[model samples]
Target chain A: MTGREPIIDIRNVSMRFDDTLVLDDISLSIANGEFLTFLGPSGCGKTTLLRLLAGFESPTSGDIFINGQRMNDVPPHRREVNTVFQSYALFPHMTVFENVAFGLRRKKLPASEIKGRVAEMLALVKLEGLGGRRPAQLSGGQQQRVALARAVVNRPLVLLLDEPLSALDFKLRTQMQMELKHLQRRLGITFVFVTHDQAEAFAMSDRVAVMSSGHITQRGTPQEIYENPQNLFVASFVGEINILDAVITGHAPDHLEATIEGRRGALHSRRDYPDGQRVKVLLRPEDLRLSRPEDPEAAEACFSGVIKECTYKGATVDIQVEIEGGKALQATEFFNEDSEDIDYRPGEPVRVSWVRGWETVLPDD
Target chain B: MIRIVKAAYVSLVYAFLYVPILVLVVFAFNDSRVATNWQGFSLRWFAKLFGNETLLGAAVNSVLVGVLAATLATAIGTLAAVAIYRYRFLGRKVLSTAVYILTIQPDIVMGISLLVLFMAVRMPLGFTTLLLAHVTFCIPFVTITVLGRLKGFDTHIVEAAQDLGASEYEIFLRIILPMILPAVAAGWLLSFTLSLDDVMVSFFVTGPSFEILPLKIYAMVKLGVKPEVNALSAILLVLTFCIVFAAQLMMKERREK
Candidate 1:
């Protein structure tokens, strides 16, 4: 999907529903054959943006271009984009085969072609023998597959999925996430998936756009978003991370020093900030390492804190260490049989340390 | 003892509701022309009912008006329900609420209002006026019925149709109509029955030249309650049962499958 020309370009689109603004100046350029996700909390405008792009709605301001053609006035029926709705939205009266063949029939395709295409789509979605069944007869996952087949059978230029997997159980959701990603790759159609699940978005999207309060807070690859959240909301919303109020005590061209309570830690920032600037620093739980206070390698900035709580997660143990100023910092460590620190109990004193570059300095807002 | 008492009470309520109808049905089979006494069981009254030219003509007229009024009302009302469901415009709330008001309003009031309107417009008191009045009342019933089905109806399915290259017409034809057909049919059946059973509105608008079964029965009852009316009422009751039973079966099939 790399180096492909832009397919759907949404420029400064804003949507307002009566008195409330649903989407605020959302601008995005989707590359052809790329799978992008709009990841956000509920009422954060991700679904609204997807609706706008699918031509279910026209923007209150700005324009949307599909294949570089203005699609502002194009109705959903005339647009080349199709949607896999959150509810699956399969026509209850139609059989699975009929549902998938609906778009082809609308195009006035020959009967044989419509049959062949519907059959092929059913096969693709692994619903080959169940075409005679109505949507109500199928399970949730099967209905979802029918919906996907129905949307993709038309070979739409862009497939917009609005939280399509939200209705499935956890196990089914995980399984369908991989299948949907695989299908998108196989089809190579530009897909814009909207979801509130960060894990699902991270697992499938090539680039995830994080939205909050009707604004795109950040748009980047999953790793970039997880490791380098630009704002406090993105940092907290994307995944669990420790946010600490720190005062910038020293400023340098490429580095800065922040003091939390009486302890100072060095951080590498792209831009220099003035001294005494109040900012928040985000530290991932996985990035924090715990060691004994008397261990030989107590180098760099290490904080001494009493363990407030320790929880044994399946793969890793989450330990909350209370540092100075009564602030609790969470640190996670994977379980190892040979590891001596696995038995770290509550109220035990420990030293927490992290490398300089692992910390993300975020804007206060 | 309590269980027996409860059962007795339930039976009493059922008897209270059905005894009159049961008596009417039993008398309809009586051999005598007078309805007061039970004569030997025979189908003479049913034969007379079929033999009566005026009553048979009115019955035919009632069927014609029922079919026409129900069809027209269902068409207009289903479209109104869809429009009220999908689009937001001025007076949408008032229009939808008006359906409920119309349904709950007294039949005489609606009939009198229509009569006044027809009189004011100088529309002749005849089949056209009667049919129009029937359709006007039936529209609210159809709207309310279809609206009940549309309560949990997924708007996303409509959007999905449009997204899949279906125009508004195609979406309604292929998706919306089929999805709500059961409700529409239920509405149409209800409207048909209401039109068939109607007397007040038909009495207000129908001229002597154009008569419906209910008004004719009302006139006959004024003259005297006869075995023929009993047989006709029993037949009408059976027809209503068949239609309602069929509707229930359809609904059950949809639920089960």
Candidate 2:
């Protein structure tokens, strides 16, 4: 991801709408042919950043570069970028063929060439024989494909997808996610996708930028963000997390000795903390292992808790545990077909512990 | 018993609306000049209507004004609707509200005001004044109609076009115009109908040299209700019906598409 000139560079970009700032000062770069996603809840400026890249909205401050050329003043039509809007935004008056051919016609390409290219694109999107149908005649997923084919048919330097699959049902959305990722790879075009769905972002993005309150809080690979969040917001937003209060008592060679939930435990951390420093420990739900309190191995380095409830998910069971100090934690255990002991009743006493060095420690925010 | 009452009420309403026009249509085919007595079915009044130079001239003038006023009003109003919908500027809200106000303004008040405006400018109250007055009244109707159509429009479609390398002009021409054409056509037809049948506004603004069909028919009826007048009224009614029918068909086709 280094040494190659970035296809897109957004430097110190800020956007304000009257009294509200939509995007704070932010800088990001995308490599050519790389798929990056801006993932956040609504009004987090993820869509605003995508719009800036598409040249629909200019930044109130700072500059945006596409293919090394500044795009602050350029109109969307002049810029080498295309967008698949959330609503699909297919032209209702035109057939699927004409909708895909719109940009090529705008470029004043020869009519025969336009026809052939449109047919090829239609075939690529698997809508070959349906080109004559109008947008209203097609189903939702077909409309989504038409939108995708329309934007990518232009073969622009950057393709911006503003939650293009959000309108689809769950199954279709999942299928489109895979198809979109494959299309991006096949076309070798830089894709800047915007969505609030963490799973969708993780599934398709080479890098994910988690945003909140108009600021990008963290940007990294999916595993990096899920396993190691920078703050509480990123930790809870990306996935389910168990945050526990811990007070550092001493430092070891590579780990810290801390009192967690009124129990002594080893805190694995990359950063150093002074003695008696207070911090928070982050753990994924699946990392916590639950055992019967009477078990000898569970007697040490564990927090005693009562099983509050058990939710039987198809692939896993979610166990809600109330720690002795009134802190509730969630633990997800995969379904074990051979074991009947996985079933736990409410009010049952249990001890919760995790593997050493599986926790992320951060200063309280 | 309830069904009978419902049918009677519906029939009564239709009769109340159409009885007068039905009388005129029936009289158009009357053999005698006397409107009260329908001697027999005849094409005599229809032939006389075509041969009367005064009525024919007025009919030509009315058609001319209707076409010209409708075209000009539609062009101006459609552009105004697009501007009000797409761009934000000072007084945009005020301008849109003003369009609605004009739509509800009484024709007599508009006619008198336009008359005063022409007098103040010392412009002759003839074809030019009549055309201007017709366009003025028709513009608000056109704008309101197009705006109604624009209410359901998706603005992201415009952005999508721009993202696909379409310029502002191309987006409007290729995307916006085609999408809103049914409304624009409806507005134009409405303007033409309004201009063709107008009596109050045209009464104040038009000069004696430029007589229109409605005013001419009014004058003819003042002397007496003649069979030729009935024939002319029936023809005008049919023309309006055809225009309205065409507009309905266009709107229905767009909806189905």
Candidate 3:
């Protein structure tokens, strides 16, 4: 995705509603033909950013550029962008065909071309032969497909989707996630998706921008974000993370020496840190390994504690181990087909360790 | 015994409501000039009603006022309701509350106030004044009807239209108007009916030169109850029932869609 021209550019944009600032100074660039997602919780300004791009709102300050054209003064109808609202916002009085054909009609396309394009778009969404039904007569999933087809039929330069799949059940949501990803690939257009669910963002987006408090906390691929989070908020928001207190005592040529949970170990980091500086070590639950205290591998373990609880999750068991100094850490262990070692009883003694370089180290804030 | 009591109770309520209208409808076909005795079954009064030029002229005048007032009120009221629902301007809350208050105000008070306004303005009391008074009172009913329909509307649909390349005027014409057509039609019908048979407001504003159906009927009844008046009342009653029935059917269709 490097060296590609950006389709949308937001420069030093800030939005204020009355006395409260909804979005602080922020800037972002989305490359052409790339799928990018804005992932955040509610009131995090993800939807506000998407609205700014769609021309439904104007920033209190700063300029927006789409295809190198200033869009701050352009009204929504004249902009070459479209949106799929969270509620699906299908015109209730119109049939599926008319709703899908609305944009084409507005562009003054001929009748025959509008009919052909609407049929092709509906077919892409797997809603063929159901064009004559009103929105009220269709199921929720069907209405969602109509909304998608309606926006994409015009082939806008950019498509803005605001939590477009949050209304579906688990099975349908996952299925639509795959379909949306595939649709973006087939269309070859830039897609800017906004969602609060991290898993949903990772499933469909090529790059995810994690947002908090109206700020873009981190931006990277899903693997980069998970393995090397820039801050504690980004680390905890992307997935389940266990934070352990660590203090840097000294530095070696390759790795730093830290006192972690009353045990001294070599911590791998690329950034330089001063001696005796306080830091926090972050680890994913799935990376932690568990074994019995008397096992030979226990010699390399970091801490020994009694198992507090075990939850069976069909494919894996989540174990809560109370380490030294009353700190509880969660470790997820997968079950092998031929072994029953994952089945552990409460109050059983266990040894917890992980690969030395797998942890992410960040300064305490 | 309980069934008999329930039946009697239902019959009493129905008779109390419909007995007067039934009497008028029955006497419309009487051959005799006096309304008390039924000489024979004939359409004599209806025939006389058609030949009487004064009654016909008054009927025409009432319809002209009703159509003009209802059309103007529907246009103004629909715009007012949309503004109240969509914008966040200053005094919006006060304006909405004022609309509700007008809907519940007494007709006699409105009539007197309108008469005083016309007199103060030095406007002559004729068709123009009558039309203005009818339009003034009919606007609140139209606004209330349209606003009731707008309360359940989802505003996101407007945004969706704009996102799909619809201008403001296009959105209103193609999306909002079509969706709220049933309510708009019902409001127009209601205003028309109210203007057609309004007696109190018409009494204050209308001059002697421009006689309307209701005031003319009142004057005739003051002398004695005639068969011609009964025949005219029956016709007006049937016309009102048809309007109400049509409005209800439009509402049901909207709900079904």
Candidate 4:
């Protein structure tokens, strides 16, 4: 609760495999009972970071304190953290009840207490009646739940998930994501989940760290990351962002005027950047609007372009307008009677307008 | 027509390989005094052989030595295979080379060399030497058979066992060993047959005190070919065939499971 105390602290941790640096110096912490996710593409060292926290590997030069205990040489079994791998890794020869009871058995608990706790944990994961069956007999999701129950029965301080839902189908993964999040909240256990799916991380974690090339590029709440990204990598990686090269013409307090191609326009962002700097403006498709350039109420710097691509997606229509000088502007028209007015076929010229008051301008191009 | 000719050629090759053994068995059962004549069948020679104690003692000795040699070879070979498969350290190549020599060396050379080495060490040459010779040759065969199975062994299962909190010893005892049991048993049975049939090594290693069934049969054949040896050969053939057949059955069961 104090500013100086964090439940988990990682400082300047780096992992080098031979000559290649697998994980660069990374420092971060999680407060008590925080659901944190390390999200990135494959081989981005997110899994390596998770393994470091679980005491599977010692950092090259850094300190990891778990609940105020320095855990440099501690083995994974001796640590207060447990990891659920993507394979589920339930013992094939043991029954569900025995598998769930294994860790406690290793701790040398009494038989009566072990039996009681095994049943309780299995029921907590909704696997009570299936105790007699082996892991091979269970479905993918069921086995995953058994793995979760097995790890949690020991009451580890932290639960580490290494792409636990990567093996599930889309619908099953979403269902399990919700279930896992709820289970973590109910148990009041800090869950550090590692995955590469943006939607899964956003849907499950209280905070997500987007890692790239062995370093965290950005870390924030799902809303903060989606609404405000610090760089082009973050903007493009976190969500769907359409980036356009623009040279700054003038700088204002709230917005920047820039020349995009031969067209001159103004782009709005809460973050201020220097004028006449070559920057890329990130525009989401939903922010662009389609209108006729002849409209008197339209904003300044309107140019006409032929529709390059169009796709109908449920309630909205996505139209890509290729402006003069081959600039593609992606615009979405809301489906309704209003869509009829904005309806334009591919190769038809129409004015593609974007709201400069919401687009993000990037610097250090 | 060419396919039919190929099929006929395959059949001819099989007949060439097996028909002589069939002929030997048939003549052994015939009551003819000569090699080609057919007379009434009788169990007179087999009955007389059962009354003789020396051939029976040699047969019993062969069975005992075969069991001991196979068991020892299997245990040592299984441990060596597991150790080499699980860990890598120095002297592995040298040890592996020694084992390769044991397997690939000619039987007569190995027999003569072991005889010289045993004599140089002032070792007793009897059942002990015979058993030692059989076990040495069988060890390499057992190791090779089990090592092939170990090469395909799934290490993930061991890691999975550890992740579920099983200790290192328990993983080996419960998971890895059980998964390779069929191969180990096959190796043991193979060693048993090889020890039973070893003539060259047994000839160099045996003494006047201990006699194996194969050496006794050879001695009998050189003295005067007996219908008794024919009867015993038929029985030994059946026993060896049964062991090989049982091993194949066990292998098939493992695959099915």
Candidate 5:
């Protein structure tokens, strides 16, 4: 995955469906043998981008390159890319073995070789001894495995997956996610996956690109995206966060001081910010800490609040605190059987605080 | 009492529909020359039907027209249905609506309109005109049946085929054609029966030279009731029932699969 040339380069691709812009000028590069995921909500153009790469659709503008060759005019059959469609799209009339062998037969391979390869692929997907069964007879998860085997049997240079697990149950989906990641590593093929589930993308991808309204708002590793999102949409879409409207009051070479509705707080940012600029301060739910009035470490940026709601989630108890200026901040505290901490009721008063560098400031939208 | 009344009503409906055909079939084997009296059971009328030169010639012409018109109609209708269902272009809605309209219009009106079309083009009302009219009307039936099958098709299956390195031509020959084959055969069978049983339309376009079986039966029936005509009608009924039965079987297999 490291120090390898990108196998698929999508350069400035834009797709318009009649009057609606489905994919804005999007550029992305997929490294060889790496699994990259396009994560977004429905109608966010992730599927459209995948289709453009698979040659199922031609972009309204720009070009695509695969293996250092321009593929603007390559038809889907001529391109060395295969897609596992969302519906599985296995020919209903064909058995599992026949479906897996379709591509091999299309290449005019000998009958004996086709049979061997198909049997090997079926075994790889752990669907051995089920070759004679048709798609209709298999369960949804089994059908999905067959679809994967069929596409992988073709030995495509890139495998494109368009929400192939969206149809499975949650438990099956989670199981398949691990299996798919393991298979991708073992096969060492470049995979471009499109999905709307952030947790699934984080679990399976080497890199994740978060898209919103036909544009990618952020692209990075899972940790970077979670800790450092570039925009408000990406921050909220990836996880839960509390956004505070703030104005920069003073600034120095390395840091800046900001006020949230007359409350003083010091903010640190790697990027430069001009003085008096308006911005939104972001705080993750787990980052905010709850304390009592007698705590000595409850220093600057502490807000006196009353607990409004508390929900125990087995592993952690989530408490929503209503602080000054009528703003609510949610804080999560993990359970510790060994510690001698007291749990507070709904109407108890408390203080909400975080460290100095815990906040992220972004330009107000 | 209510159950008995319900049974009586159902029996009455069945008898009303089947009695005339049953009489026609049974009287074909009547030895008497007159159909009003059944003197005995025999195969004399069937023998007379086979020996009649004029009726046999009409039967041959009808078979020729039915086979030719059915093949041509199925080919054109399958292509038209694929275009109407798969692609979006200018006037697509109107074209499909026109096909629907052709199916529902009265047969007399279509026969008259086709007669006018042939007359305006100065085409002689003979084999060519009859064949042309049959193909035109049969196309809509074939298209409608095929379109019904196409309604449930998942186009992504074709895309998946292309993804597996099947070219456009190969995909059509291997995937699309095989998937829709049952419906296509049903359409062809339906067209054949429609052409074979046609009388009103054939009466308008079929000239004196290219006599067909249906018109010959009509001409004979106009004279009087004859046992020979009964045998011919019985044979024609069996032929039509066989064709329609085959079509239903094809459609049933498609549904079950």
Candidate 6:
């Protein structure tokens, strides 16, 4: 993996279907053996981008180089890429063994080799003895495993999975996610997965490209994306965010005083914002706290507000506070001895705030 | 309230539609030479019908023409239906309209036009001519039946097969063919039934050298009502029911499986 060049290099690629511009000019480089995910909502062209990489569609005005060779006119059959579709797209007419053997047979590989490889793939996907059954005979998860084995038996340079786990139930999807991640690790081939599920994308990908409406909003490690999202879309898309519009009241060398709910505070940031500019601050639910206004010396912008709602979710508590400035701030706190006794019922006024710079201050919407 | 009304309407319409056929079927089993009154029930006319050599030969000719027509029509129509359904090309709308015209054309007009064209071209009017005309009439039936099924076909499955390294021909042969085969078989059987029972097209396209069962029955009806004719109609009815029922069973099994 270290010695080889990047497995796929997409340079300024754009695709359009008649009047619809499916994918805009985009460039991305994917390293070999890296688990990369294309994360986006519907109509984001993630599937189209995957098809372009698999040589199923031609990029309108750019180059797609696989293993350092430009592949534009090459058909999908000639390309070293296999796709596992969202529908699993299993051949309903063929048995599991036949479906997996289809590619090897196309290459005219020896019969012995074909059988051996299919058996090995089926075993890898943990469907070892189920090869003789048709797709309809198996459950959804089992059929999905067959689809994966069918695609991987070809030994593609990169495996393209288009929301392959979307159809499975929650428990099975979670189990398969772990299995797929491990399989990729063992195979050490570039795995470019596509899904709109944020948790699944974050769980499986080493880095993810979050696309919206045919353009990538942000591309980064899951941690980087969740912690330091570049803009409003990435911040809201990657995770649950409690956004607040705060005006800077004063600025210091290492901190700034801002008013969030008619409450002033010095926001200590390792970054900087102007003294008077209106900025939106993003606080992860867990980063917020509920306490009295007496702890102002140690706290940042403490809002004197009423606890309008409290949802007891076994391990953690979700509380919605009606803060000053006519805004409701949602926060989650862990169940501890202090929180257990404090029944901040509706209409009970409380100070809700967080430590300055506990969250990333995003650019204004 | 609406369901009751709809059921009543459907029953009345169906009774009106099938009253003639029911009359014919009942008369075939009456064993009486006259339709106004019933005599003793007997199987003697069925025995007598099987002994008519001229009627048997005409029955055999109609079967042969129907088989040939069904074979040719199903082959071309299924292919045309698949092509029209699967791919987009120039003049597709025009081609589709042409198919609609083929299905709706009156059999007598189609028969007369075919006769004049064949005669002007000096083509022989016999079994081959009758077969050709029947096949032309049946092509639209096959196309309509197959096209209905193809419309319900999951096209993504075909694309999936192709992506899984099956060549285009392999995809069709393995995936598309098996998926649509029951529809094709149904279409073939339907066309065969229509061609075998046809009178108008066969009337014009066939020369004196060849004759069909319907023409024979026509000639018999003109002369006098024969008990054997009713028996032959019973046999035809039974054969048609068997073919259609078997086709439907195959379809049901495919659906269940």
- What's the TM-score of every candidate structure? 0.96, 0.95, 0.92, 0.86, 0.90, 0.92
Model 5 residue A248 distance off true place after TM-score fit, in angstroms: 2.7
| Per-residue lDDT over B1-257 for candidate 5, one digit per residue giving the tens place of the 0 to 100 score | 99999999999999999999999999999999788888999999999999999999999999999999999999999989988886789999999999999998999999999999999999989999999999999999999989988887887898999999998788877777788889999999999999998998899998998999999989999999789999998998998898889888988976776
Better of 3 and 6 by lDDT: 3
Write out the backbone clash pairs for model 2. none
Task: Give lDDT tens digits, candidate 4, residues B70-161.
Answer: 99999999888887777678988787678878887889998999999899999999988899999999998888878887777455445445
lDDT tens readout by residue for model 1, A1-365:
54589998989989999999998888889999999999999999988888888887889998999999999999999999899999998888889989999999999999999999899989988998999999989999999999999999999999999999999999999999999999999999999999999999999999999999889999999999999888888889987999888788986666787786568877777656678887787899999988777776555545888999989889899999998678899988988888766679888878888866788876454
Candidate 2 Cα misplacement greater than 4 A, ranges? A1-3, A252-254, B1-8, B30-40
lDDT of 4 by residue, A283-360 (tens): 788877777666654445455788888898888888888889887777777777634666677877677667656677
| Residue-by-residue lDDT tens digits, candidate 6, B71-139 | 999999999888888788998878877998977788889999999999999999997788889999999
TM-score of 1: 0.96
For candidate 2, lDDT tens digit of each residue in B152-240? 88889989998888888898899989999999999999999999999999999999989999999899889999999988888888988
Clashes of 2: 0
lDDT for B172 (candidate 6)? 74
Pairs clashing in candidate 6?
A256-A267
Candidate 1 residue A207 Cα shift, in angstroms, is 1.1
On lDDT, the candidate that comes out on top is 2
* Candidate 1 lDDT by residue in tens digits, B1-257: 99999999999999999999999999999988788887799998898889999999999999999999999999999999989987889999999999999988988998899999999999989989999999999999899878877776787988899998898789878887887788899998999999999987777888988988998899889988988999999999999999999877776676565
Query: Which stretches of model 1 miss by more than 4 angstroms?
Result: A251-255, A298-301, A363-365, B32-34
Clashes by residue pair, model 4: none
How far out, in Å, is residue B143 in model 1? 1.6
**Candidate 6: where are CA atoms >4 Å away?**
A1-4, A261-263, A268-275, A293-300, A337-343, B1-23, B29-31, B119-122
Best by DockQ: 1
Chain A TM-score of candidate 2 vs. true chain A: 0.97
* Model 1 residue B24 CA deviation in Å: 1.2
Judged by whole-model lDDT over C-alpha atoms, candidate 3 comes out at 0.91
Reference-based lDDT, each prediction: 0.89, 0.92, 0.91, 0.83, 0.90, 0.85
